[model samples]
Target: MKVKSVIVPSGMEHLTKFTRKIPSDVNVVPVTNDDSFSNIPLKILHPSKKGRGKNEDSMVLYGQFGLKSFIFMGDLDRRGERQVLQDYPSLKVNIVKLGHHGSRTSSDPNFIKQLEPELAIISAGRHNRYGHPNQETLNTLKMENIS
Candidate 1:
């Protein structure tokens, strides 16, 4: 299979280091808030706020497939999570990709309360350094009754 294009958050083109390894014909599409995919139901929820460093500026995506809805929070911190909650007060999802790999810096208790995701996905390595998927975060998920 061949990759056709890469959708990167606007102003974060430098983050796509893998682009150099891809075929020259592949397209790099820069996207901003509220941008929707042509072939999918996903939309960018957070603006690509530059100068905030990488983690804070990570893209926040919301999408729906069939009757299920989900949100992918890209390394967002507590402040960013609060901002997202403020932006979309009614936002709820069946699945959520927890921010910052379930670190204490992200996954605010109130944020999870508001989101009320059925399942929380944390991308962290097993027994790796940095102590990812922190116990506090896990407790928050448990308190929220999320799987």
Candidate 2:
């Protein structure tokens, strides 16, 4: 695999430990703002403004594979979404990987309306303790008419 670099969330260097073997040439980048991988379609979009505590959902990436455009929201909450929307008012995406484990805290109504994704992908574990993919999120998707 020819990998140029591995970008990760800010303050999340510890997650790198799970990887098997990283080539010496690959530079692991931790993003603090909206940055894109040069010569690659993948990008990291930090929704939160500076000084937003921890920013666990720091590595928000807008990516494309084949002809599909999508964005991955890494546990981003409403506040983050608000900030992202405020910055990129006209942002649009074909698909959106729901953030905050589909918790109500993320995927705000106005934010979803702005993106108007053609499809919504919710990641969750079966019978998980957190009860992720909350009904409110599902209802929001339904209300938005996002498949």
Candidate 3:
């Protein structure tokens, strides 16, 4: 199967190491603003605007099997999501992996409204250090009727 990943510059080190554990048969596509991995088929979703110093822009990856798409926000903030919405006005997706584990720093009301993804996944270690998936973020998702 083909696998696509969006890696913000700051997360590359960890992601790179993690990727090594995956099977070689999978085709991995990493999207990022870092030129260091330029030779590795990086897709730049936002080029003009400066994203979170480490290139924090909202990225969309189309699934190889179907028309479904997944949007990955590597610690992207509200502003970044807005920029993405503007960049792709007609953007739609099947799933959205919430940025920063649904931290209050991200997930703007309008951004969530626009995305309206069928499923929202927040990748966070259960009851770790930071209190992620903050109440406000959950409320926001509930307000938008997103599960």
Each prediction's TM-score versus the true structure: 0.87, 0.78, 0.64
TM-score of 1: 0.87
Better of 2 and 3 by lDDT: 2
Off by over 4 Å in 1: 15-23, 48-53
Cα displacement (angstroms), candidate 1, residue 131, comes to: 1.3
> How well does candidate 2 match the true structure in TM-score terms?
0.78
lDDT at residue 2 of model 3 (Cα atoms)? 56
Q: Which candidate is the best by TM-score?
A: 1
Candidate 3 residue-wise lDDT, 27-102, digit = tens: 5443344333534432454433333344354443323125667777767777777877787788776777888789
Q: Write the per-residue lDDT of candidate 1 for residues 1-147, one digit (tens) a residue.
A: 788888776766655555566678988766777577778668898754543336787789998888889999989899989999998989899999999999999999999999888999999999979999999999999998999
Candidate 2 C-alpha error for residue 91, in Å: 0.6
Worst 10 residues of 3 by lDDT: 56-65
Residue 145 local lDDT, model 2: 97
For residues 14-93, could you state the per-residue lDDT of candidate 2 as single tens digits? 55453436666777665666555577677667733333324445557787788888988888888888877777788899
lDDT of 1 at 107: 96
Candidate 1, residue 12: how far the Cα is off, in Å = 1.1
Q: What are the lDDT scores of the predictions, listed in order?
A: 0.84, 0.78, 0.65
Clashing pairs in 1: none
